[model samples]
Target: MVRVLFAGTPEAAVPSLRKLAHDTEHFDVVAVLTRPDAPAGRGRKLMPSPVKQAALELGLPVMECDPSEETFLAALKATGAEAGAVVAYGRLLKEPVLDALPLGWYNLHFSLLPQWRGAAPVQRAIWAGESLTGASVFRIIKGMDEGPVLAQSTVEIGAHENAGELLERLAQDGANLLAASLQGMAEGQIQPVEQPQGAYEVAAKITHDDARMHFNVPAFALDRQIRACTPNPGAWCQLHEAADALEPIQLHVAKAVVAGADDESAPHGLKPGELKVTKHHVWVGTATDALELLVVKAQGKKQMGAAEWARGAHLTEGAFCD
Candidate 1:
């Protein structure tokens, strides 16, 4: 068996770790490396990372510390691990740590590589209206996701898929790809291929500003942004109306669709951010079209259909949203 060290931190990495742990014939996952526990939830109690929790459930030894720590390096060396597999490990691995393992490291990234090569690939892909996005397994180099690919698996993005939903599907698909890559490498049948020359896009971490909805863009672009930001910072806009003592409310839109010009309620020639409230929909004007909001969550309120919220707020047809 090839002794392996698994390094990862988030829920997205759990499936890969589980795959390695179960495939005992070819891989012996000696230890798991994850970031230290941090405070979470309302009480702010320390919470173990998803990877650490999964490792504990599998009765595997886990090291929750910085990869740069000397103690961590020593413990990792003691594991006699011949190889390492990384999936969404939050921190970068230093040269000394990488040298400790004989077979080096393989990273399972959630993008096609050289495409969305950064921290938030899944979110960026959806936000950019990418119809196809997939996973890649590559050798970990010093550069950021600039490694040679060992294997890759393509997955189609659904028309209305949100970032969270797409990520869940890719995580499992990535696990399967990782397993196949490791098996091929162990058998000496696979070789890493250098990334092709091209101008690739970067997927920087999503900031607070990125989640704010911009109605000035086309309705399709706004729809993509809304889907990408769901279950995270959430796609939000400012409400100008005052209803039920809620003025200038920050509304998080959960679901929306591009409205057809044929809709009679959709105002013609209205400026972007202008709203048209109807009995069954809340349409907002955009640069090229209007977006019909389906689900929305207002400040200090539970998620509800946009029409329901409009009814309760007494929003008129001429109301505007910033």
Candidate 2:
């Protein structure tokens, strides 16, 4: 059995850590490395990361320290780990730390490497409307996700799946792949392949501005944006009332769908950002087609059906979103 050191944070990484711990035959998880507890929730009390919580529950020793510290290498070596597995640890490991273990470290990334190789791979893929995305187990190198892949598997993106939902599925599937890859390495049955040379787009972290919805774009693009930002810095737009009595209210779009021609609720010849409310649905115009707003949250209000919110707001005829 290979003595393995696992490093991760957040709920998404819990499955991977649990997988390695439960597979006692091929691996022995010596210790877990994770970030220190930080403020969370409404009261801002210090709380341990999901990985840290899981490690404690599993009766495994846990280390909470930044990987860049000078003592990190010594601490890592003392764990007697021959190899390491990282899953969204949220820190870059330098050269000395990389060489601390004899068998080297591997990372379970959410995207197919040489593409979406950055902090927000899953979000970027969904935002870009990628039909296909996958998980990769790659040997860690000096650069960011610029490593050779040991194993990989492809997955199709669901038509209406948001980033949060897709990530939940990927986390579970990636856990199995990660465990298999480590097991194969221990048995000398798998070989790492050098990544193909190419200039691929980076999945840079998405900001609040990046999540803002612009109705002037095509309906499909708007749909992707809304889905990409569903449960994070949610997709928002400025609700412009007919009279500028108050500043534009922020509206968070929870769900939306492109208005098909057969839908009787969809208004015809609506200009961009134009709002049309029927008894059952609320429709907004985009560049190419209208979008049926299913759920939305107005400023200082709970999320509700778009038509319900429209009725409660008493919006004027020219009221719209931008």
Candidate 3:
């Protein structure tokens, strides 16, 4: 059996780690490497990484440390592992650690590499309105996600899919690809292919500012932004009332769609961020068209239908959303 070291840190990496640990015919997962435990949850208690927790449940040894540290390198060398597998390990490996494994390292990235090569690939793909995205198993090199691929698989993005949903599916697909790549490598049937020369987009880490909705764009663009930011730093806007006694309310838009311009209920020539409320819908004007909000959550309130929130807030035809 090929003794391999597994390195990863998040929930997305758990399936791949479990596959390697349980598959005894080709691979013997000797040890696991992950980031150190950090505070989490309401009480701020120290919590183990998802990968570490899974390794413990499987009775495998685990090491939690910064990969750039000398002690970590020394402990990794002591594992007697000939190869390494990485899935969202969340840190860069130094030359000494990379050289310790005879077969080198392989990374399971959630993108069709040479594109969306960064931390938030899934979210970026949705925000950019890409219809297709994929998973890749590639050799880990000194550069960031700039490696030769051994295996890959593509999946279509749903028209209204959110980042959380797309990522869950990709995580499972990536695990299967990782297992197949390792099997092919052991049988000497797989070869790494270099990425072609071209201009590719980068997916930088998301920030709080990215979650704020910009009404100046077209309705379709705003809809994509709302989907990309859902179930996390949600897409949000501010509702300004004419009365000074009432404070501006922040609303998280959970679900929305582009509205037809010819609809009789949609008022034309309204400025961006202006709202028109009806019994069934809350329409917000944008640059090119209007967006119909289906679900929303006001600050300090539970999630509800946009029409319900509109009724409770006393919103009429002339209210505006900043």
Worst lDDT window (10 residues) for model 2?
Answer: 240-249
Ranking by TM-score: 2, 1, 3
Q: Write the residue-wise lDDT of candidate 2 on 1-322 in tens digits.
A: 9999999998989999999999998899999999999999879999999999999999999999788988888888899999999999988999889988999999999999889999889889999999999999999999889898999988999999998888888999999999999989878999999999889989998889988888898999999999888788899999986745478999999899998879776787888999888778889898988999999999999999998998998888888888
Models sorted by lDDT, best on top: 2, 1, 3
Index of the highest-TM-score prediction: 2
* Candidates in order: C-alpha RMSD to true structure: 2.1, 1.4, 2.2
User: At residue 192, what lDDT does model 3 achieve?
Assistant: 89
lDDT of each: 0.89, 0.92, 0.88
Error (Å) of candidate 1 at residue 232 is: 1.9
Worst 10 residues of 1 by lDDT: 240-249
* Model 2 stretches astray by more than 4 angstroms: none
- Which lDDT tens digits does candidate 1 get at residues 1-322? 8899999999999999999999989899999989899899879999999999999999999987677776877788899899999999899987888778888899999999989999999999999989999999999888889989999999999999999999999999999899889889878999989998788999998887889987888899999999898878799999876433356889999999887757776666767988878678788889988888999998889999999998998765556787
Model 3: residues with Cα > 4 Å off, grouped in runs:
241-247, 260-270, 316-318
- Higher-lDDT candidate of 1 and 2: 2
